[model samples]
Target: MAAREILADFPAGGPRGSWPAEEKAAELTRQGQPATVRMDLASDRFLVVPVGERS
Candidate 1:
């Protein structure tokens, strides 16, 4: 699966249009943030969101 870094500029509260799910999760963790995997049925893509900080 594809992955990206979680940017501090990430929009809060879920992804808006055309955003990947898995990459989101991977990025969140990569950035030392807690995140959960999410699947977008509409785009058939996975995403991740930060649940908390690595602290």
Candidate 2:
């Protein structure tokens, strides 16, 4: 499978849940870079990547 370009990452342990990652994705989308959030279980972090990207 093709590797996705990660736009940003946030710790999964954040007290605010996934809000930060989700907000980042939304912001990127509004900026024309359409993005989404996915859980990186191995790294225990939230990854912000382009829409349709898969691990």
Candidate 3:
């Protein structure tokens, strides 16, 4: 297994759904970091990580 570096995290309880996480990933991508979001069911949060860094 590979280790994924987390760039950011958003709570799953956000009223705006996953929009904030998506937007953050997009902003990171535009900034040249190339990020994406993944759900952590156990922790109940959205994780922002670099592309290809899926756990």
Candidate 4:
């Protein structure tokens, strides 16, 4: 499998948790680019990555 590039990163367990990352991913989705949000427990940070084909 190919490695995914992280589009954004934010501190996890924040005032709203992963909501911030989710919002950024939603914007990317609205722009027609598939994306996802994940949390890194070790790093205590949220991550956003683009999915599917890369243009």
Return the TM-score for candidate 4, rounded to 2 decimals: 0.73
For model 4, the stretches where C-alpha displacement exceeds 4 angstroms are 1-3, 52-55
Candidate number achieving the greatest lDDT relative to the actual structure: 2
lDDT of 1 by residue, 1-55 (tens): 5554333332234546644455666666787876765444555544454564221
Instruction: Provide the global lDDT of candidate 2 against the true structure.
Output: 0.92
Quote each prediction's TM-score. Answer: 0.37, 0.86, 0.86, 0.73
Tell me, what's the RMSD of every candidate?
Answer: 10.7, 1.7, 1.7, 4.1
Quick one: ranking by TM-score, best first? Answer: 3, 2, 4, 1
Error of 2 at 8 (Å): 0.2
Among residues 3 or more apart in sequence or in different chains, the pairs in candidate 1 whose N, CA or C atoms overlap within 3 Å are 21-46, 21-47, 22-46, 22-47, 25-48, 34-51
lDDT of 3 by residue, 1-55 (tens): 6677999999989884448898999999999999999999989999999999857
Q: Write the per-residue lDDT of candidate 2 for residues 1-55, one digit (tens) a residue.
A: 6677999999999884448999999999999999999999999999999998877
Worst 10 residues of 2 by lDDT: 10-19
Off by over 4 Å in 1: 1-31, 52-55
| Alpha carbon lDDT of each predicted model | 0.50, 0.92, 0.91, 0.79
Task: List residue ranges in candidate 2 displaced over 4 A.
Answer: none
- Tens-digit lDDT string for candidate 4 (1-55): 5665889988876784448898999999999988888776878888888775342
